[model samples]
Target: MPWILVFLFCLFCAPAQAVTIPGVTTGASASQEKAPPPEPDVEQKKAAYRALADVLENDTSRQELIEQLRKVADTPPKEQVPVITPPEVEDQKTVLENITDVGRHYGEALSSRFAQLYRNLIGSPHKAFNPQTFSNAASHFLILAASVFTLYWLLRLCAWPLYLKMGRWGRKKNREKSSWLHLPLMISAAFVIDLLLLALTLFVGQVLIETLHAGSKTIAFQQGLFLNAFALIEFFKALLRLIFCPRVPDLRPFTIQDESAKYWAVRLSILSGLIGYGLMVAVPIISNQVNVQIGALANVLIMICITVWALYLIFHNKRAITESLLHLADRSLTFFSLFIRAFALVWHWLASAYFIVLCFFSLFDPGNSLKFMMGATFRSLAIIGIAAFVSGLLSRWLSKTITLSPHVQRNYPELQKRVNGWISVSLKVARILTVCVAIMLLLNAWGLFDFWNWLHNGAGEKTVDVLIRIALILFFSAIGWTLLASLIENRLVSDVHGRPLPSARARTLLTLCRNALAVIISTITIMILLSEIGVNIAPLLAGAGALGLAISFGSQTLVKDIITGVFIQFENGMNTGDLVTIGPLTGTVERMSIRSVGVRQDTGAYHIIPWSSITTFANFVRGIGSVVANYDVDRHEDAEKAKQALRAAVEELMEMEDIRGLVIGEPSFAGIVGLTNTAFTLRVSFTTQPLKQWTVRFALDSMVKKHFDLADVRAPVQTYQLLPAPASGTPPTPEEPTL
Candidate 1:
């Protein structure tokens, strides 16, 4: 062949390689030579050339690679529909490109679109690398995203402040209409502030974008710089508010003795503020830890907290539990006593069973390496299932065969209603939780873990991450909310053998505790789940600990209350309907509890006392009681006559058919105990039945009064006789006499 022909053939067949992108081609221009490639760059070129030659010889692999890249994002092109702006369609296309998951396409679809627009507005526009159509769409998409996100975030942020403002306005306008949540005022304030923030973020972002587009990069970057600064400021401002928000309502009145509510409010507020601060400062830091470390810390902290909380709860629960246990031990508790004893014994056994759950989920045996996971799984299922089924059956049997109380018969409808409601709720909740847990376990058992692994490791698109978080939040939030609700419900539904709801404060304290436990449990579950999927949950663990410590320090009263409650439970301190006295206050035990003791005075006045303050306890209804009395008689009668008459009356009283049975052992009369100018007093003594002393005394007194009236023996009435102030008007009296 001619040299010129050879040159042409060589140029054409040499297989031009600039990362030979299958069909796409690039010129070997001078600009491409500006920078030499990294090590083995020449080798890579030659290999690509060889591959190209081989593909030209046989095209299957090249075709496969081509197919894979194309299939990476199976996006549909935008179709311009009327009334729908280009920006919206562009947003749809961008979302399709960025988001990878097909399953979650329908999930949070609206939020995903909104987030897309937000990203487009805030994200950089790579005009050089991206195609014109795509770049334009992304930019428009970003603008929309920015506007929407700013609006939504701003509105939510202003909600509380708006509420406060509205509350102020409402209170000022109509003091009678004071409400905890001032809705009207809040709405108005929210509208105004929301508009303001939206306008500001948009205007600022736009101004920067436009400035950059018009001429100066420096000026535009500065504006971006300003926006960043604004974000920083907003963050700090939120922190400041968190730190000082407690003082916003000016809780100054609690210093007075009468304003106990104010005092407790102040304490709770301070505690809340400290907790918020702790979270704000520590959450971000702790969130960075790996799941294993976080898990270890969480395990340690939880164990510590559990141990501590158990100690406290035991104290609080002591009084009631001990009473319950004593009744069981003494065999004095009413109704289904055997059944109750059986259930309680089962409960103790079952409490130990909760830890077996960890074993069920364990992929590897910690205690015994020879233990096969399959065998462990089967064993766990068999044991727990059998135990649970047996427990339910036992409970059911007890419910049917337990002793029937007349008191319960009178309130049968109320009891029935309460029992049915709790049963239904418990069953429903249990079913749902079981279904959900089974689903999760099934997914883990199947091949979905690999998908989860990829998704969690930033392998999925940004949109997917956002969607996952939303789904996660809603999912975990639902779990959290459900667990919390269940806890509260169980507490309410469970039989309350010890105390009544004495006061609103005590109720609130109990509710707060129940809610706190629920939240903690829910959060820990979420963190643990996330950790299992490879999320670094160190920050969450650290934050939880710090939050707990802060709560412990700030809400020491609450902690004390919980602690006291446990002690009460374990010690069998007191229970409702028992008579007790603390300090100067004496009243019937209206409500006995761990957090506080309630005493209702004889006058129907109520006194609430924290259990921590109670170092000793005195329970009535344990033994016999004594009644001593002095009966006064008219001085017009002889003292001996009165004593003889009183003795005769007592003897007659004891012998009477209506009154004799009330006396326990005997009636004793001590004669002529006291003397007065107009009357003499006779002493009487009697032993009476436990808890029936007052009724017996009243009947006996009435009998005595009636007999005395029949006998013409009168009770003394003392009257003061006053002479006129003699000296003040002596001269006037003398003049009158002379006249």
Candidate 2:
């Protein structure tokens, strides 16, 4: 058994020895390279294998190693261990806490910066005021100033003639026949001339700088600072002059006394110069030569002076300015003038607030504040000016009453009035819109909102679309109503050279159509507007339908009234201006609606009677009317005579010019219709045109009385006398009948 094991192990070891290790040379190959080893006999190989097997069988360590190798081969390879990193933990601070922390951080930074500024301010002179440096800077500044002054003198001398000519021209133009364009043109010319002078001065200064080879910082700073200050202040003065024209009274744009104009111009110019020079030139030069802290301190002082000066000016002129604005408002009596008056009332306070805010802003963030304020102010002014101009134009154009052609006016008189009223309303709406847009733009300019971004965004786009749709809807609705009204009015009135007068039925139907059209148009416009404005009109429509159904069920009487009125109108039972008897009330129809009719009675009472309540209706003006007169005569008198009297009265009524046209036919007499105890009754009926019954009846009755008197026909009269019933039981004397 040991030999077999050894043999098997030898076989395995042989293949292993033949397999090449990556970096090792086998002993057989090494020997071949040198001298080949002598071949051993098979018996020697067997002897060597038996010896190795005996060693392996007796060695406990070898057995253990083999067992371990076998176990290693049997086991599967281990997989790599995966690494798991924990997710990053979120910060515990909320938004408000983070903001507070940021604010605190900025506050600490600001305080530190301010402290640094204070230290720099205290030490600035020590670092900045060496004698040599001071002398050098002063010498350079004086040289630059002298050069600039020389240049300015030369430029002014050269331009003096032109400036004088422009001024004279402006004055002469003002004295000429004034037009709306003249003042603006003169002011523009003056502004242009002033600008030309400024440009020439600046050009000369630039030439001087270039000629001097202003390479040194001191020279450059002085030239840049002083020249820019001059330009700014001069430009501002030019603007003031344009407005005030202090030297020329007639050229002044505003209506102010010459003394007042000159006063304001000079003072304002001085103030602007002080503020502009102090901030633009003084502070910058100080900072360039000394330290930024001193410049900042100087800036604050200058701002303080400006604020105080502005406040003084505002308060001093507050009452006068307000009164001027009030006078303007009274004269103009327009919406813009009213706004000016309101602004005038608060202008002083507004001015004070503006300066104070500017001071505070400069104190907080001096670098950007002035730029922001100036830009915002200019933009806001431009916005307001444009809006005001547009509004004024709209008002001027739309304020006039619309005049229609003669034919239209004659046919439809109310159309012109209605159109004019609509125009007035449109003007007001346009003005309001312009004001609103101006406010929005002003807010945008002042950084209150980002209007352009909002306008480009989805919400603003949708809003604009909705507004446009609403406007269109309203416009179309107005047009529809106007057309309907015009058409209906044209139908209602008589045309001498055109169509004849509309019948009562035609007029009634047209009026109803006009009202119905108005209601429908209004309903459709409202519905479309609601839908456009992002309202879910489905629910509204559904609710309206349900409500209408409920109303139809709940108010059947209203439905009945409407239905009855419609039928009555269609059948021409009664119309406006017709004498109508509805139920127990008798009146002339004054107005009619879908559900009710407005009746004005002879007693001056207006009754709104629903059609449903009209059980009996009689229209006296429909076709023809008959007036019946009855006269009773004495029993002894002949009834034929009374009939003859009535006939004679009707004849007389027909003879009258006014009543003759009203009487339609001859009178018919019923002789002796009845006999009473005292007299016999004779009835006669007169036929007349519709609506002429009352007039004809009154005239016929008067004629009847007169004719009866002329014919000596007597009506029966019964008389009673109470004889002294003195005796207790004496029967009363019998009443006697007298003719």
Candidate 3:
């Protein structure tokens, strides 16, 4: 048998090569490049044949060998033809051509796959509805269901006391008055309890399957599927319970009515159970037990039902939900209120889009659709909830007014006001940042962005660095302003002894310095911030310089005003609260700026006089003022007596309580400076404090009149008496009056 196999192998192996026999020659070798040797003649062929015949004659299995030889002779030989090389293309395909080719191939593959699915669907029902298969599947499903139901009930019974406790805690009243942590803690406890029950049920079910049903693959598969479906559906129901908490109105985080909460909880649980079980357990089980096409058809039907149901619920409750959201937004005083209102307006559309997207995902990629949707939904809700909570706390804290201690307020009153304003702006920035971060997290969770990778990338690192620098800049800027303002205020405020109140001129200069410092700090901060944000500030600086040049050239009057005002301020010309006269307007200097001074006139009209417009300026409160009084007496009367009366009046003025301090010097009398036909004039002058000249003059005049009257010093009077009009203007007569 071994010899026969070896002989057959040799005969069949490499048929393209010529077979070699002893002393026999074939011309097959001549085809090679190597030249052939001389060929064997007819005598050599006959000798080789004779020797093979003798070997066969000497064999014990002669007949078998002859038959094998005949068979080998009948077998046809394989012929070898000359090798040929195919031609190569001279030009390569373009990118567009390659893409087109790829698209065509992809389309073809898709069409073929779809065609196969259609054919399978057409024949799947016939194959799937076998009574035996149904009996087996039904038996497995029933056993699995009974086991899961028993396990679930047992777990629930064990956890019933805990559930009751959670319910009571959730229903507790006045929870809002409790710590802010109460709601989160209660919700977490309820979720944990629900999750514990689910885990216990699944764990017990798994142990039972491994112990009793380990030998049966069908039973194990069915039980595992049932447990997975239960866990998934129950997990979703747990989230729903966390949100709605139907039995515990106080624990419902959202401002939803009890009835509405209950309605939504029940309906949502039903929906979740249907989708989760139908997709995760039912479709998989059917696909495994029956046909994939039947399973796909079931998946499509279930998704359609879910989509229609969801749309029905959304549309049915659209108006009520929108109104509820609007009311909530109105009640809410947080930064998210506007977002909530906007969401309310478009919530129905978003819901519709969600369902449509789910349907498409299920239709196209049924295997991972449920997992992707559930994960994305949970992550989105969690991100938004956490963001809202944090942002709310921030806004609440920032909304409060910062009260400084009495010492700080006394020293720096404006600091508290500035701090509050800064906090308000910070709140807005924090809210915006929170929203942006939430969006990024959601996108990352949904596979729309690779946030982790981006965070580690160069651009993201630089961005974070820039933000940090900007925040530091802003913080230091605020601190610098506060310290500077506090210092300025400390200098301006009077001490306990009231000895060092800043003069008006000093106050004005300090105010201008403060303003200039603020401008410089602001400009420098902005420039640095712009640079940090990757903006080229050189161009901005150049632009600013050009703008300044243009302003200087175009507004010569403004330039003149500023220059003149600067000189005036440096020269201590005037200050705020100084009684000054400029041009035609004279009043108290109410306010002063770099280019203009606001003065209120005695008549109650305010004038803003630019420094360039001020041609003449007078300051009444600069130095000492003088009061001069003139008194007249009859020339016939005793001049000595009149002078003595005036001297007595001056003595009386000095003895008065109000006028004594204002008088800077003793009164000086210039006797008989002028003589008139009716009277002679006596002048008395006294120096007083600045701006007290008018008061002193009035008091001195009253004293002089009283003295003149007491001394019988009356001024002469000239009177004219007209005759009777000269009988209708025929002649006019001039008359002199008697004194």
* lDDT tens digits, residue span 11-47, model 3: 3332234444433334344255355444456686578
Clashes of 1: 36
lDDT-best of 2 and 3: 3
lDDT of 1: 0.51
Ranking by lDDT: 3, 2, 1
Clashes of each: 36, 0, 0
* C-alpha root-mean-square deviation, each candidate: 35.7, 20.3, 22.7
Question: TM per model?
Answer: 0.31, 0.75, 0.78
Model 3 segments more than 4 A misplaced: 1-137, 153-187, 212-214, 248-251, 497-499, 716-739
Clashing pairs in 2: none
Model 2: CA > 4 A from native: 1-180, 213-218, 308-328, 360-369, 496-498, 634-652, 675-678, 705-712, 716-739
As a whole number from 0 to 100, the lDDT of residue 175 in candidate 1 is: 49
Question: Residue 372 deviation, candidate 1, in Å?
Answer: 44
TM-score of 3: 0.78
**Models ranked on TM-score:** 3, 2, 1
lDDT of 3 at 680: 89
| Per-residue lDDT value at 687 in model 3 | 88
Query: How do the residues 484-582 of candidate 1 rate in per-residue lDDT, one tens digit apiece?
Result: 555454444323355343433334445556667767766766776676566789988898799999999998987788698676655545555666667
Question: Highest TM-score: which candidate?
Answer: 3
